[model samples]
Target: PEVIYLAGIIDRTPSSIAMRLVNFASVDPFHQNRGIAGLSGGKKQVEPIWKEFIDNKEDLLFESEKILAEKESVSIDKKFAHMLIGIENLVGESKTREVKVRVNQSVFRQIVLANYSSKCAISGIDVPELLVASHIIPWSKNEKERLNPENGICLSSMYDKAFDKGLIGLKLDHSIVISEKLRSNRIKPYYKQFFAPLEKLKIASPQKYLPKPEFLEYHLDVVFMK
Candidate 1:
């Protein structure tokens, strides 16, 4: 990921990156030792990959426990005991790296929901299952912002689709901006009911997450048809 590679550049020379990768790949029991040995770079060349893997591993080990904490998600907390049982399935002989991915996603979702009071940012819909922690900046476009809560906005399923497709955008001041097409559509009333009022509403919980201005600008300029 860009964040991983960037950190490698910041912290280590190219030669160190290479050697570290070989060493990590060799010692990681889950990976084949032969593959590690086949890697033929100095420490600098392998630094990026090594750093990322180590970082992910550390996050998994540390943050996975935090997942059980009630502050993250009330729903998850209510069923925390059951969740622990499911997590146990991934431990020991059944352990898989995918478990970490699941945990990461959970963490992201909790962060988003907590920030929005489990309500959609635009529609104020409070249905937990229907809400999404949609990234303001496309997740694939920015690795550095991948897990940044400020990079996310809580959105309902329908509005999430609209926002993701650029049918709507938010001004830096957090006012809703409807695309001309949407404003002119027959469904304008429906849109107005849920979205138009947002223009006047200050962000409900600015403390939970602040939308990145650059990402908002990207949506306004490129994504919103207007």
Candidate 2:
């Protein structure tokens, strides 16, 4: 139904759109690794766009959103009015930078959520309101990778806080590792009911852009409690 609606808006057949999606999947590394051969004929057309996304995610993602807004006959600012509310008073480079940052952050969240199929990677929570695009490497610590899909993880609010605060971490194998601080509370009801069950459990693999091992190492070295 969604594909049909999109096809109507774009004046194309639903099959065409479906095939295009398959083409995109063909170019996706995750699908490639899984031995899924999606519409190879259209792969070349989508490959360049995928390369551009990997090379310059922030700019490409913002431009894509802007283009979508234009296609809908709306201004980018108006399309993201709620998220861009507080920047009205600013102008010039400062305003431009702020707008780009906010828009790109929103795009990052969308990409991360889609990667995880809109479910929390750890707990499989499917409620969008309870999910967050948690950064493996702190956003402030890496400007170049701030918007990288590989640097993000979908997690529920509770686990997001736990991961952010070093109460829990992920090993190179993607298994959960409880901090000694959290482990100290093992006898507590909450620990037994929540934290204990997660210890050494592997997170659900994302559909695309698995978290980079380097980012996981950074989190282990710099953020995880001993």
Instruction: Write down the TM-score of every candidate.
Output: 0.56, 0.82
Q: What do the candidate models score in CA lDDT, each in turn?
A: 0.66, 0.91
Q: What lDDT tens digits, residue by residue, belong to model 2 across residues 1-226?
A: 9799778777899999999999998888878889998888987799998898878877887888888788778998898887798899999999888888898888788889999999999889999999999999999999889998899999999999999998999999999999999999999999999888997799999987889999999999999998
Cα RMSD, model 1 = 13.3
> Which predicted model would earn the best TM-score?
2
Q: Give the TM-score of candidate 1.
A: 0.56
Residue 8 accuracy (lDDT) in model 2 = 78
Question: Candidate 1, residue 34: CA error in Å?
Answer: 51
144-169 in candidate 1: lDDT tens per residue? 66676777899899888888888778
lDDT of 2: 0.91
Q: Report the poorest 10 consecutive residues by lDDT, candidate 2.
A: 2-11
Q: Lowest lDDT 10-mer window, candidate 1?
A: 75-84
